[model samples]
Target: MAERSIQEVRAAQPSRDGDGVAIYRVAGMQHAAMDPVLMIDELRSEQREDFIGGFPPHPHRGMQTLTYMKHGGLIHEDNSGNRGEIRSGGAQWMSAGRGIIHSEMPTVDTRGLHGFQLWVNLPAADKMNEPDYRDIPAQEMVTLAAAAFDATVIAGNWTLDGESASGPLQTLAARAGVLDLQLQPGAAVTVEVAPGDSLLGYIYAGSMLHEQRELGPRQLLITSHGERWQLLAGAGGASLLLLRGEPLGEPVAQYGPFVMNTAAEIEQAIQDYQNGRFVPEARPLQ
Candidate 1:
């Protein structure tokens, strides 16, 4: 029943990734890692030049990624012979347990590509497990509609009026929760979060009042430990992404796409990639 206060507020930094796809990088702003969450990138743009190049093939290890698309489409291909398209209102969750080679490219000739890519860290114990993937379409996700607010549950459960909505991603190692929330003018919503959980929110449209502070677009809000928090939309209304997860509280060693527990493990990941041991053609999922 304690009130949640904002610990910090930071504006997203502009950056480019995946073949010049422009994005606003939030989280990981002040450190190499942020407990269970590593990075969050807001990729929303209407210009073709901002995302035409697309992301070529790449590798990842010891991490989980959740890609939620709101306005555009992305085609994903992995070395394990898995391929899919995450269209508007769809999502894709991929765990690069031990290692995985994959590529996510924007759908060509499409404008207004907008979405978010969130990176969640894997604990050391689950870092070497088998890689896995899950794709959830828009229709499959749970939605809660009300007169004052609308929300979509992406990776956890939300209950209102004795009805509950659950997301498809349930097996995350970090026990993370993801939600997309939209509030009409003067509307407010309270979200319950456990004490000691790392909670963060990114505002993409309009502004919201949280803990007596106003957060505007492109700003990231970090919350202190509390039982619950309340967010009230400004006059223009607001759309925000909410993320919460228990902290891993483990040492992290990261080098580019490789994340491990020690420097030696990071080196090993590099050597594996160089020697083709991590490639699909070399190992070939059995």
Candidate 2:
């Protein structure tokens, strides 16, 4: 496969929230036509001047959101009566099947917080299942490293180590790959995907030349088939998230936060929320 041109490299826009820390959003990095793995939004907050508050209770349907903490703490409460507080190294995987409502707030430590919240869209079949959440403490995650790159398999398969998060919420199918990778300087990595699948790379730290284009922090690289992309880290090294998924060939009638096959279905989702038939109050975190 020849090198594909770098599609685009754009920084995540900063979105400040009620919480003090700044939040960067990398929403729908891929074009709507590709139906690529959608990262609806991301948040990074650190304790320094003040705490980073989070989105108040909100609703979600037909998607999954994964939250991993690197530092500080996050307290989560849901209308389902569920409450969970995650500290450094902890993770939360929530699947808003048919629908659910929840809130995530920062703690008052003033130490700041750093983490990533990745949203994955559910396929047509699983879109209406009962919503669920899996809280994984940092200690429960698997960490593996190669000479050039080290990675944590948070939700999907790891071909080399064969270890992954075995919990209630997982990567889902032959359709998804969610990996957090850290590469040393001068290192390069290559990934292969099933034909017609969606592939994307997002730089979180440092920079790299990808698909013949220079990609710095916060930029995403989306690729098509017949292309073998190589990522080279800068002298300071780099960190990023690698995502791939099978394309859902069905028509995508997306409206705001909900994605369905038809506009009428999207309308139903909105009406469900308005009628309060969609809120799945949280269950107390055990």
Candidate 3:
């Protein structure tokens, strides 16, 4: 087995989105190496001024999103006539297959939020499938408790030392493996990932050592090669979001919320929205 090394490291850049809500974002349009993953946003703040205006009703097409909150809440409503609340440790997975309109408004509180929204590109064949939505509570996701670390499996499967766990949403298009990982201070461990899957680690708390470089909060690590990761937690302990998925290797064209395979498709998406051609309603998840 070869050792996993860093293909690249990126720090989430401070940016504003959705009515000027502050966020640390790792953008995707510029990075070809982050195949299947189009974007990652880490939203963290307690002040009302930072997150008062949430994402209003918006249109989306041809992509999937997974929202995970470490601590916080969000009220979600979509054209499907469905509404739900996502509380601490809860997650929401939505795929705007053909098209859908939705809004996500945050719950205000002293604890605020420490959460992530990740986008996964879809294969061209499934781009126009029916939209899907899911809200999963913390208790529904699989949890792995180890001596040195604790992890929440959000999607796909995780196996270590002959023990295994699978996330609730197994049908994600990219076969994504999403994990919220926390390592005790100074603890070290090795993790095995699917061979050839594109991988990323977004650090949110404390720091982690990868070879000689120490990655702190707001930093992201991508795989250069190999299937195993050597991770060491800093003295203050560490927490990170681990994501891996098979690359689609397809051409990507995106305009705002719409993602497609070509510029023409992007333009068509815009026209469709304007023409009211987008799906007017969605079917509830069965």
- Between prediction 1 and prediction 3, which has the larger TM-score? 3
lDDT of 3 at 137: 94
Top TM-score: which candidate number? 3
Candidate 1 runs further than 4 Å off: 29-33, 159-164, 210-213, 279-286
TM-score of 3: 0.94
- Go through the candidates in order and give each one's C-alpha lDDT: 0.83, 0.67, 0.84
TM per candidate: 0.93, 0.82, 0.94
Ranking by TM-score: 3, 1, 2
lDDT for predicted candidate 2 compared with the true structure: 0.67
lDDT of 3 at 177: 79
Per-residue CA lDDT of model 3 for 62-115, tens digit only, reads: 999999988788878887666878988999999998888888888765258778
Ten-residue stretch with the least lDDT total in model 1: 277-286
Enumerate residue pairs that collide in model 1.
Answer: none
Off by over 4 Å in 2: 1-6, 16-21, 29-36, 47-51, 160-174, 211-213, 226-229, 279-286
Q: Write the per-residue lDDT of candidate 2 for residues 74-154, one digit (tens) a residue.
A: 887766666788888788877778888877887776376778777677778888988777687877777767787887766
